[model samples]
Target chain A: MEEIKDTFLHPVVPLDFQNNYRVGAYLQRYLDGFKEKKILGAKCSQCGRVVVPPRKYCGACNLVMEEFTELPQEGTLENFTVGHVNLEKGQWKRADAPYVIGMVRLDGAANAMLARLNVSPADARAGMKVKAVWKDQVEGEHADLDCFEPA
Target chain B: MRNVGIIGIGYTPVFVSKRKDVSIVEMISEAVDAGLKNTGLAPEDIDAYVFGNMATFEGVNMPHLWATEHMHARGKPIMRFATGGTIGMAAFHGAYYHVASGMADIAMAVTYEKHSEGDAQVGLMGIITPELMAMLSAGIDVTGQSGMGAIGGGSAGGISFQASSYLHRSGAGIEHIDAIAAMERRNAAKNPYAHLKDPEATAEKIAQTPMVSWPIRFGHICPTTDGATVCILASEEKAAKIADKVAWVLGVANCASDATTANLIDSQITDPAEQLPAIMASKKACERAGIEDPKKEIDYVEIYNGFAHQTLMYLEKVGMCEVGEAHKLLEAGELEMNGRCPVNASGGVVSTNSIGTSALNRVTECALQIMGQAGEHQVEKEVHKAMAHGWGGLMQYCTITILGDKPKKL
Candidate 1:
């Protein structure tokens, strides 16, 4: 039997999709808090646990979180990763430099928030005190809170 | 419920980075034919079919519709399932249900992934694209430092957090991850179908690989491959009549947690390493299988480890060992093919990952071990019972299947 060489074909079918989503009432209130530089967290009625970016339901207690509380900007870094690459549209590319992405447990909030740690990778450590850095001019947006820095 | 047994198992000739000679449906047909041939049962013997794949990876929606004839399910009842990386096991569960429900005496589960046909990372990114787009529209700079931090490194990024948390909680070091990666790669060298085989692999060699994140190295990642798997299942009566050796499906269970547990931007209330769902699913499945102590009765384990640390992480989560004992077990050489509780003798998903076939391969590998059909990768010990685990969906979903050498007595 004669061996057959593999052939290839490349066809481009561009599929560009745009979808709309409703942020819901709880997240709406949470995002709105950014305008005032207030970090709002929803307090679960059953467990009394607070989560930042206030969600409506608590997964652990299986209860609604109707009460909102303002969390202090300062928190303790609970865990972090020093990333050396960036995923651009799902492709891996070398980052300009290594950066720390920290999991910070803000004061008064039971859950930890993920954000860029504005410190050298070597300086980032668990249990280190940090504070939220707000944009120079605040707009009601997710990025308005910027990154977290050493307090 | 009727007892179901896996009577036949089939795989594509090779699982590699690319299959340039075959098209998507063509590759799937090979596995289907292999299953039929292995069972000595024609398409007529199969009363139903369950098909699955991550459709987005191939940019082909409703692929089952296209693969109907190729899979020999033109007129039979067929159902499709897709659940991130667990689609393979999810489809297997669907086929098991068909037989257990008394709906069909024999059923076939087919799963495949031709990642070479399309972009896998893009498909993985699609899972969170809606949320990412919503954030972008809400004035979030996805390209900015904070935004990149938020996205992390896509799947690898989110996984790094889970890996780091697992390291912290388990008190294991990066070297353990390197060792497990090397061990599995060396195991892969024995399996002809495995994609990444390295007989000379060592922890030192793996550690030399560049770091993608703090704990996740490039060597720790699973390669996207092109392959298909087919499993034929039958009722107890049919299994006894057709196959001399059968791996009985003793129990199947799955558990799902809140997706927000690993939702990076929303803040995680539960630690990613705290896989309560895996524990719950394993406990339930083991109880149903009459396995009171998995550490003793379970002879083999095939864990869905897309990364090396996950093998240790899930081993602890699934109650195979104590909280921080998996790495200790690794150091004791208890996880090798010749060890007391051998794991991933077929090299595991970390060695060869065709996403859709990855989880199903776990189950099939276990079945092969149970049937004493696993050739080069077979463990030295006699296998009586084995556990197969599948995990996917933002790290929240877990599916477990317990298999035994003989059918459970009613």
Candidate 2:
């Protein structure tokens, strides 16, 4: 048997890939609605299913969602998790404090959206009613619709 | 479709966290060489090759091109596949098609992953990076509460939600997850090629590990392993001529649902715990294999359980047991190596996970059991029929392969 020696080599390969993505018409409308404090969802004509942060196609029905509907701010917390650590570039770092990441099912929306829950980890539970929070200043951005809190 | 059987299987010398002794191609060659030696076949005996790996994890693109000489794929038909964690089984399915379609009499599926070469988290984050960047460009503070909370916790964070949902719906607790982790770890101790071997593992010991997220502990997660696995498939005629023991591929099926189950850019339209694709694929595979009741007909199962809970979760989803009954079976000791329906006797992906080889290893493990080749980890029951499952691709894709002791009768 040939003895093998361990060798290590670290090479610096600096490569940055920049990509440009179009927000598309569906998401653009959803974002634009944020400025007015309205939660927009697209309704699939075939299935009548409404999805938040609307997209063009409803995969189950295979139909284009052309109709836009305003979703109610209050909904049920479908599911949640309390994160004790943050993953930065795939590395784990203990968070300063525990926080709640909840999946909120907005009223009239068939799908559940991922959002930060304002409630403490101890107080968070699935199926609890919650409402959306908005930033002080209106902006047509993802940040405009702030975290959700127990209603 | 013609009958195809797994004639031989080969694994790298070891599956560990690091393989500093060998380069990526060199590591891959070890498995290829082992496969050739196992079947007493030379390089020229392989008619085609199907290679798979998560290139992002290794920072290598089109690795098959570089591994051509090592894999004996030079001047041979070679196809590449990458479907997240299921790449291994996907490549195996590709090789099966090669032989089943009569294009090649002998085909080899080669899958490997060297996680030490690149960042696993970074590779996983790459799936949703474009979406995050899109939001960041639109003035969304991705580092803030809204962005980080939704998409920041890496794979573990996202999976925690699924775990919690599974617990809630299945009436199982975190203790069941602990139990499954301990069970698989103990199973790994019997497998020479497995990475995380804990002969004295117990549910209480696993429960002591710190929680990464609610319902998910450090002990429940799979380690990033460096290893390669190669499986050779041949037509029935060729298999009879070359190998005395062959694991016949009775049925193979895969299904993909919408990618929204991962809750990446948008919200989740489907419940992550409600793995419809697994149900569909398993049903289709079992039906094609002429299996009426998997619980009674199937003798063994190899589930691609990256998380311990998945072993139980997929059992229900694949119709091995009633929904929410897996944990109950666990309590009855029915899922153990000596139990009625032994699952993951080779420790499963939860014990040894090299993402690219994880799924393929499931098939190979089942084949080994079917052929009565799994020495130390072989289940007590005689395995006449076995099922192998692979899950990946943003939680939407599922591949199922059913292997039998004898080839299906025409």
Tens digits of per-residue lDDT, candidate 1, A1-151, equal 9899895322122344432223456677878999998999989888888999786556565344679999999999999999999999999999999999989999988889999999999888899999999998888889898999999
Q: RMSD per prediction, one decimal?
A: 24.6, 24.5
Give the per-residue lDDT digits (tens) of candidate 1, residues B1-410. Answer: 98999999989999999787666766887899889989999777889999989978878788888777667677789999999888999999999999999999999999999887777766766675544554455556665665566455556766787899999999999999999999999999999889999999999999999988779998999988989999999999999999999999999999877663243333435577888778999999999999998998899999999989999999998889999999999999999999977999999999999998999999999999999999999999999999999988666789999999999987
Q: Model 2: residues >4 Å from true position, as ranges?
A: A1-151, B129-143, B262-268
**What lDDT score is found at residue B132 in candidate 1?**
57
Residues A4-67, model 2: lDDT tens digits: 8894322212244432223445677888998899999989899899999786556565344689
- Evaluate candidate 2 by giving its C-alpha RMSD to the native, one decimal: 24.5
For model 2, residues B196-280, the per-residue Cα lDDT tens digits are: 9999999999999998877889999999999999999999999999999999999999998755433332343446688888999
* Superposed Cα deviation of residue B191, candidate 1 (Å): 0.8
Give DockQ per model, in order.
0.01, 0.01
Cα-based lDDT at residue B303, candidate 1 = 97
Q: Can you give the lDDT of residue B274 in candidate 2?
A: 84
For model 1, the interface Cα RMSD in angstroms equals 19.0
